[model samples]
Target: MAKQSTKNKLDTSALRPLLRYAKPHMWLFILSMVFAVITVATTLYAPILVGNAVDLIIAKGLVDFDGIINIIIKLSVTVTVTGIAQWLMSLCTNKITYCVVRDIRNDAFAKLQKLPLSYIDSHPHGDIISRIISDLEQVSDGLLMGFSQLFTGVCTIFGTLGFMLSINVKITLIVVILTPLSLFVARFIAKNTFKLFHQQSVARGDMTSLVEEMTGNQKVVTAFGYQEEAEEQFEEVNLKLQKVGLNATFFSSLTNPCTRFVNNLVYMAVGIVGALSVIKGVGFTVGNLSCFLTYANQYTKPFNEISGVITELQSAFASAKRVFEVIDETEEIPDSSNATVLTSVDGTLDVDNVSFSYVPDVKLIENFNLHVKSGQRTAIVGPTGCGKTTMINLLMRFYDTDSGEIRISGEPIKDCTRDSMRSMYGMVLQETWLKTGTIRENLCYGKPDASEEEMIAAAKSAHCHGFIKRLPKGYDTVISDSYSTISAGQKQLLCIARVMLSLPPMLILDEATSSIDTRTEILVQRAFEKMMQGRTSFIIAHRLSTIKNADTIIVMDSGHIVEQGSHDELMAKNGFYADLYNSQFAVT
Candidate 1:
């Protein structure tokens, strides 16, 4: 049984990755700070002006209309100017945030390119995509909008407190008495909100993976009449996601209302206290009381803003933790630090005493040895689960051998850079994956620098040119959906064409023609003959006739090579290869 993963926890260390992205926007952040200062200063001045107006009316026993108009005009102008400044600052902040997000996406993609095949095998594609899309968006929201509001709120809160105390310390003290209680509630909501958001992200990834699987295997689902089963599975995941999402929403939604309620209670307390002070002849005027009340009301604005920001902060931090998990993962098969470029290679290959296992206790290959001279063709014939594909995987450095070494051109593959090692071989797997794009684009993927003429020649060599030419746009024809326009044979041929375009010195064919019809197989086999000439090749074939002309053949059983030699020699021995050949050809 698989070990259960540990519960998701907030990783404060994840914040360090954000600093690299923020460095470029330091100047803009500083400007936003300046704008925040101006905004806060303008906001705090309003209560003081009202207080002064009240004093003037009480002292003179008459309303000074001119004085009041002047104060109103000055306050309005200050507010307008400060609002413009804040807008300018917000524009710059948003630009920086989006740019950082774009960089993060690019970085993730680049890192994926460098990762070994084993990493991809261990992780699902949809989960990786969720980190790049949904997770990054959450982080961006926090950095762009949440950070600005948080900073402004903190500044406003402290700034308002300072001015309030200056006017009347007694009233200020009463209003702020319940702040700690509000903060405690905010903290509780934030903690639970983070947990819920993390669960939501995981559930979303699971749903994405299920949807991708169902879409990609719709034919199998329909053929097996398993639509109800699939729908049930999907609903199970979707309902789980809904539960987590609702919990996250509920926790986040509680922040504002709870903060507002506490703030109102504090305001009422302040009113009661101020009225008692006036009744007791504490020299509190009506204007003084009114100004203090206004300031008290202003005090809750920052708390509300902060509560909202806390919810966003929790989500952002959760997303950042996920992204950092990817970034922090040590690549299991990284290139050597001092590895050199292999500009050209001759395809001499050797595998000495190789052993491997995906799991710790089960061995896939043990004491395996193989050799192919430059320009030689070798075939590995095996029953299912006999480790033939694993041999190919080791040769391509998809997974490093657990013991012993693999060498190409007499150099250990581990010593060479992965880029250079991969550059020397052309591979075609059992399942052909074609991207949604033009024929030319897919063909050129293996050799981006290949000219248009070279692409056409490769297509012809793969025997796909005739079908491609029949399409509406020939090489430029677009394949929107993988299933609608292309048959399995066509996709396999396209894979062949793509490999041919690469023109590598070594080739590995892993049931490359398995999905094609017999006629198309003959065409593909002929093309393979042309492409494999004078190149080291490894053929893992299911059809016995396909490898009849191979220079050498090896039969494998239970992860061990059991028979070796030419096809006739193996037949003469009447051993495992002979049995396999007889069993396969008996019906034919």
Candidate 2:
């Protein structure tokens, strides 16, 4: 089947990358293998000692008691040493497995930092998280099983076979011939199960994404009475996951029982053939036949173990492929080696002949141009679907333009290192992000070294100081994005305070005060006036009342700037800007 072929190809491809992670701990791997050899050799030798004790009993009265006593002592010592070797092998394998998993997790997280924001925006946060957490955990389980069982199982198989061959060639031949049947059964089931397990893993990721989406936006779902719809969506994904999971489980479970049946047949044949050889009075004595039968059982035991491991390995390979996908994505374009780092930025911005789109053939911003002198306040106003946020993204170089040049203080941004260029501006967006930390930590995020006096001043200016003092621990109270105690307005004010603390040369405020009450908005707007006095500022406002004092207001429609002027001039023109401004303030 096409699925089986795909499974094989992916297994081979995924293995190389995994081995590269394991190669760093090759010494541990080699030590585990050495212990496995010692464990298997002693275990096989114990059965031969038992056979020798049986042969020592010639008759009840004439038995060699000393010989039997010596064999018992040897057997006891052999079993104890085997247990110690097995314990050491397990310890080494465990170390190697966790070490490799830790390395993989570290690499995956580092790769995410280098990935383009576009890649993150396009994928589900929960799915990416699943690959790094749940999927990697699956890989860890698989690796542990592999190292613990695979090496020991392999050594046991060959060790048992050699012992059997030395005892009697014909009986050994019977086992070798029948052995392929077990392999065939195991391979046939494993081939079909790999694709099913892969599907199950993907389905689980989808379910995780849906759960994250609903939980993160529970307020929206509750406000709109969308609980029923959300439940229906969750049930649909849950059913699909259950179906694929059951199919994969059913197929993999068949591998063990089916192989055991074939192995049981091999055991029965060896028993009958060896019993006949003993009755024929051949050179093969009772002890030799018993030893050969013991070897036959031990030989076939690994087939059962390895088949189970193959089932587990298939799932591991599938999960590993998902983790690798994130690590292998093309990262953001690196800054040129010779890129200059801007210092003492003057805040002059020039955007000339710029064009861009998130998707090809659906242009968003085209041939846009603008120039802002240092210390001037420019306002950009547009309808909801217009490219207001896209313009901000371009200025920050979150996504590169298709064709254009944006220069800051006469230096093209593309030629400036992203860190230096972004450092020149303080930004506050409509969406607020607060990490899980104390209020003081969040306030001082942009300026870690800001003094307590400076942080208090910024918070007071943003009008969030009164609320911060009311919390249980004042500034020391810990909070996160899901901290239910904080209102949306307070979160926005905290973000504004964060930007004020940094005091960068330029500012980008995109609907920055949308959540604040009208009374607080007036106070914050006055504070913003003082902050923007000499800093070049870009303000994107839906409320026309907020940007009335802007020296230049650029009105955009469908990516092109239709009008650019002072507020009074745009009002006099009675054109698109006038219509947009009036539409917001006119009495209903």
Candidate 3:
């Protein structure tokens, strides 16, 4: 849902959003341009002074110490002022570029929070990371360099044209004629290289995705002895990246030398024209002829620079487009204008005639109905792809149902504020996620003001306190993906302790004890019994030992509840439920 197919071309639409982002910094941008103009205006004087120095030498021999000294002083002062202005200009440009990038990054990340779960499920993690990090860095850094050159190059072009025309209109016409050739060369090369850069960008994302996937599943790769296969896969993606990168850079690199060649031709024309004018005596002083020659060189230099700016700007535009693509995706369905805020959840829930399908043609759940009394343990057991997880997702409102309504405390959940609804539930999923932080900090994430006593008590109950206290820094030790000083089972125990610390009115424990050893599982189950009291709890477990004593057991198959009862009731019936139980335990 997030990825969109775009034609291979330079789309100016990406720049519109960038211009909008820049609007807040409009005055700052203008001030930067002012400094740029000052720099270029001062630089334009050096050539004129050089021409005057030449005139002085010819008019008063080469021994005019006073005239030479004065010209040298003026040249030095001009260069100093120009350098100061250039420095100021760079400061303002960097400020604008980075600020704009910061806003873009913020919006892109915020967009991810609002995007549908399906969008995240469908896209690769590394591709999304590339768009957020690498692509944005490219856009900002490239624009910084490209805009700096463009601002100065443009001013130099117009400023040089004015100086040349003032010196001699006929000589100025020489540049006006040859300048078109340089622009033509630039446009032709840019057109070819723009698409190549875009292709290279896509290839870079592909390479990142492959590497991330391989790294994340390293254990599986090694166990399967897939090293050679993984390396071959990487080489395929790396080769594609190399090919496109070479082509894009190859074409982009051609612009400078090609434009310079045309510029050199313009310079030769000016030299010839000035010498002819000097010979023909068209009332042009040697100083004026020399000034015209210098102006011609200055004029042609911006053309070469502008060409390079065009190449860099294309990469910036391509990255900007990728970033804007994410920002522009349709946001999650908004809460109601006057949404109800759930409070004091009673744990009562009713699923009425609910139907859902990930794909329109393949219905996963149809006309599903269920109800659980307040403060009861409801267990859902099902085979893979039997919509057990989907039901949990609906209960959490991570996804909306296609039809019918889900209610909590006899009020429709759709009308409740999602934040308030979610705040009522404490979830410990099968997958454990812990950001880089101390154990105490991770425990207090859902309840920032939790007391130290509450944290230690919950850790003790969840059978995690013993292991945590053994760590180097105890509760203060920092943990991360790379710096995991704990085992997987220990990590799961921490997750349970986190939920125990918060102590919400409702709970979701999806295979929460799967990682713990058999001995640890028994202790955790005692903690769960205490935690589940006076609160609604939903548990999805593959091991029947944990849920055998649940207040209600629901068996789901083919998107429908096939059998549901207490352990004794289902076993007495001796139907599908008895058969399923016997299959798991009746080993030959």
Best by lDDT: 2
Lowest lDDT block of 10, candidate 3 = 1-10
Give the number of colliding residue pairs in candidate 1.
0
TM-score of structure candidate 3: 0.97
lDDT of all the models against the reference? 0.83, 0.92, 0.88
In Å, residue 273's CA in model 1 sits off its true spot by 2.8
Q: Per-residue error at 413 for model 2, in Å?
A: 0.8
lDDT of 2 by residue, 361-413 (tens): 89899999999999999999988768989999999999999998999999999
Measured by C-alpha RMSD in angstroms, how accurate is candidate 3? 2.5
Cα distance off (Å), candidate 1, residue 91: 1.8
Error of 1 at 555 (Å): 1.1
Identify the runs in model 2 with alpha carbons over 4 angstroms from their true place. 1-4, 58-65
lDDT of 3 at 111: 99
Clash tally, candidates in order:
0, 0, 0
Evaluation by lDDT, superior candidate among 1 and 3:
3
Residues 215-292, candidate 3: write the lDDT tens digits: 998999999999999999999999999999998999999998999899889989988888988889898778877787
Which RMSD values do the candidates have, in order?
3.3, 1.6, 2.5
